[model samples]
Target chain A: MTSTSTAAVHALAALPQPYLLFLGDTTEAGFAKTAIGLHDWAPEVCVAEWSLPGCPISTGLPTMTPAQARAAGARAMVIGVANGGGVISATWLPALVEALEQGLDLVSGMHQQLGDIPELAAAAERSGRQLINVRVPPRGIPVGNGRKRSGKRVLTVGTDCALGKKYTALALARGLRGIGVDADFRASGQTGILIAGSGIPMDAVVADFSAGAAELLSPDAAEDHWDVIEGQGSLFHPAYAGVSLGLLHGSQPDVFVVCHQPGRQHVLGYPDYPLPSIEDVIDLTVRLGRRTNPAIRCVGVSLNTHGMTEQDAQAACAEISARLGLPTADPMRQDGRFNRLLEACIA
Target chain B: MTSTSTAAVHALAALPQPYLLFLGDTTEAGFAKTAIGLHDWAPEVCVAEWSLPGCPISTGLPTMTPAQARAAGARAMVIGVANGGGVISATWLPALVEALEQGLDLVSGMHQQLGDIPELAAAAERSGRQLINVRVPPRGIPVGNGRKRSGKRVLTVGTDCALGKKYTALALARGLRGIGVDADFRASGQTGILIAGSGIPMDAVVADFSAGAAELLSPDAAEDHWDVIEGQGSLFHPAYAGVSLGLLHGSQPDVFVVCHQPGRQHVLGYPDYPLPSIEDVIDLTVRLGRRTNPAIRCVGVSLNTHGMTEQDAQAACAEISARLGLPTADPMRQDGRFNRLLEACIA
Candidate 1:
């Protein structure tokens, strides 16, 4: 028995690339951002997406079952959707339990703490698997003092709620890394937390410590490194604007990128609150950010053109660039421009 | 034993007015704000003070031992000072234990949770006495949405840290109440929590929840009533400005009172950061506040004149009123003027 376990451990260690099972079960419509972004990024470690039978595949990635995933040398199951209300569906529990039983770690950013659940935790313990909750923020985070830190920070803010702030931040991190720039992704919400392995659910945190969480996530990184902090909600969303301001103050970023979904008309719940013009957003961001950091500046605009025609997306990007006098692009398609703009701003 | 317990209960119930034993052991300079404020407020309910041997009596009230306190109809013990470091001193545990044994309810606003101490919990449980931790903020507080609520909110903001923001707020609440206005005191810190009977320690709450606490503390006050929300920290203090901003946004006050300690040189810890002029503070508060409520205004000034001569205090108040074209007063001394100013502003 000992020899068999040792051989299995050796086999797992010998695998050169770690495989991930992207769990996007029931991912459709409003909950598919994480899956779609992951599919677009095409991280080399991710092997295949998983979903329940009859569920629409939003990411268009290859599919696999828990057994198939384990057989393919998958080490972890990554939750790739912010499901409605952040609750893990009962259909996913069997898969999560089976994966744990097969020694595959369970990774999630759901507000419903997976590790705190009894059956999944017991299964993981029995199989020596780990449960990682990305949205569990660091404890005892101090209230942000707004003191200057050592490293450069690049925050991705947005024109409206869920307009690809996390995607822009992640893409920027990747582009900077491609250019040999030492950069790290600082996740600010649930989906970003799963993608980056750790983050604070800014909305879940107590109001006073919203900025404190942002500060803790992107603390004094080394002088040569860049901390790309993910943005949450938006300044226009009345329900979540307080969070946006707290994060802006806490991060104290020297430079920022504004993310927007072109042609979006109004904030989600309150139709009366129309989306601000691109220039208005830029001005508001700078004005709000500089209250805490006087030297703050906007370097670029990240456009989320997922449902738009290529021609329309290009037109929108051009218009934003011309009006705001800032470099603008779809970060996933034109990641290098975003990186270059950030480089210029920080330099 | 049953007869003796019954008689004791009757004796306690029959007392015309309950007495309070004020605890201020080890009280010294830099740790007497609570005692001093409480002394000045001079609540008729409190009967005597308790302090360690050789410690100066900052409140100038009568003194008593734990046993003597109970004999004098003291039904509760109030912690009367914000001790250094917020930790409960070991020297006071004996006194606390004796008081609990004597069946006196314990009230404190210290960060070191009184109920969490095993000995104190056991004693209180055994004697059927209550332990109140006033700074324990409400749980599951959602992020402030900056939505309009019924009634008027008047927040007290300051030019720098520890400038009597809480004292001014409490005094304003009292003055408004004295004029038969339905006004409530909302506490934002430990000392204020102790005085008001409940409040969130703004600094201890997570960043996102700071404003939420403010919102929760003064929720849906009646149309005829005014909620005087206590402010925390200062807009210019680097160490805690985020909290101040969060509270300001959360309260969504229709008007504000700018609290200043005239002639103060700088922010408490960072000497290089000088205190802003009164005009600068008022402008900053209004500008920051209006982001949430566009019609928000600063209608008055509350000055802390602790060390100033009476003539100097009057001159300072007069200068502020003349410069800002607003009512101004040392809330403790010129109580009626403060009340009238608040009435006029809300009216």
Candidate 2:
């Protein structure tokens, strides 16, 4: 996702909760992931959901209008839809302006700044509300220097985008903490930022400073602490490998987990190329990851078998583990199936 | 180099030529590559050079002030110094504002926008002159798709930054044209953009669009035509590797030339990380490059031996060529030494 914000994420982190989620008029469940993620992960901060007519998807939160949300104590309205191109839709502007008019701050993670639109800017000014763009990175990010930092890191890498990298990282970080390990799940995408309340949107950063931003995201900590970084695009992805490589170099993860989806045939949008083999991903990750951290290795494989039956998922995980000689599990599997992956990471 | 521009490169390509070169007060020859490059490669468009007093370097062009250069038929003043941080120095503001007041359009390739400075903006407006920041990328860049374009491409990959990747690409493209071949030099950095007239500042593009920009830089062409692409950053670089990898995948070169400086032991600005062996670069580049172009190969090696004597340089090239069993030459050497490397590329 493209994000461009000059606003500090500290302000974003404290966005007056609970929020009114705005789902733009997109029927694609993929585009409404923000609302679903917030509802699933940060329910405490979500008051209700709002969408234009015929959007056909919901976060299952109570439906409300801007005025009703204001009365319901939502201090802010979060744009809960990620446009395919990271743009603010002209059709959705009327609803956004109403949210600002109703005494609520407007928050977005799109690359386009909200203040650039005259109507939104005027309404925000008239209502004395803030327009927060969390995607814009703060200035003065240094170029990455390749200096090693203290603390261990575990980055979740994938063969493609939206293939369980973020979910695996979140599960790993939470599981690490559950096992008495000091850990933090570092977010790198817009939806992850909204859920965690702070993150550097890696894809939106200037090309020159992406690695630097990754370094800033997970700074120095205790030697035993772990920063489980939410990965962006895969190392093999044609469009986003730059962000992926920069983050890999800067995070300097001592170990990483390879996250993949079974039964996928090609990169998300590019049909000319087929998906790379899991072995190829592992080989490239290790060779390239060695640049920043020589000890880097793949600790496990996290499969996203959302489409498969329980029996098929178990068989796939076992086959992959035996083939790669690494721990394997579906972190999102309903029956606490992340135990082996978590153990491999800490081991 | 970092550049952000909303203006189209078509406008930048037609920047009023017959220019005055502005050499900011820097004793470092490296930072003055912009002036040196334009003076050497595009001298017909250069009228004179200007530098703050006490600066130790010169492009050997006659010295002149903004007014004097304007009187000499210079239509624009090019900021000929590249700041290491891609920032505009406050100390250089007076000279820049004076250029605008003197009726010469001011042009810069710095990441900081020229119109963002109040004094420069006011002076340009009052004088009816334009302030051009070529570093800024125009909006609407798409994500890379890794589709094969109908052209043969030769990209100059480097072992480290500032190791003659641009020079090698420029020389190779020129040589190809000399032999009755259809070839175009594609620039991906500020200096190269200034020289080539129209090209993307790859380092300045948003991380998400950089690969897409690269794909745009070398689009479909005649089957036998060659696009000699100037690369940015090294795969070993901590900060800019993302830009490098994206460009590599997008360029999808059929053959690549590895450029290196003979004695450099570490990355230019990063002192802690040792440079990877040339063999390692080839191995990783081919392994990763095959994802986009399965036929990719390292054609030759280009060394920057400006610091060495002719005899020493020849010895170094010969030694490396013998060691790797690949053709090696100093493309910038006297007496047409790039012949072997050039032959390798097209053969």
Candidate topping lDDT: 2
Q: Candidate 2 lDDT, tens digit per residue, A5-85?
A: 437643224445679999989899988888888888789889999999988998899999989989989988999888767
CA deviation > 4 Å runs, candidate 2: A1-6, A10-16, A24-31, A50-58, A63-75, A82-103, B1-6, B10-14, B24-31, B50-58, B62-74, B82-103, B126-128
lDDT of 1 at B243: 72
Model 1 lDDT tens row, A1-347? 21112222211012222345455466364576666655665466667778766767646657777677778877777777676688777777787788778767777666687766777767877887777655555456566656677888889888888778988888788878877889988877766655565556676565556666677778787888898989877765545666787788788888988888888898765565678777777777787677567889888888999988878887888888888788888975674556556566567
Candidate No. with top TM-score: 2
Q: Tens digit of lDDT per residue, candidate 2, span B190-306?
A: 778777766788887889987898898898999999999998999889899999999999999999999999999998978888998899889878977887899999998999998
Candidate 1 Cα deviation (angstroms), residue A221: 4.8
Candidate 2 CAPRI level: high
Location of the lowest summed lDDT over 10 successive residues in candidate 2 chain A: A1-10
Q: What Cα-based lDDT does every candidate model obtain? A: 0.71, 0.85
Q: TM-score of each candidate? A: 0.84, 0.91
* DockQ of the two-chain complex in candidate 2: 0.81
| Model 1, C-alpha of A324: deviation from truth (Å) | 2.6
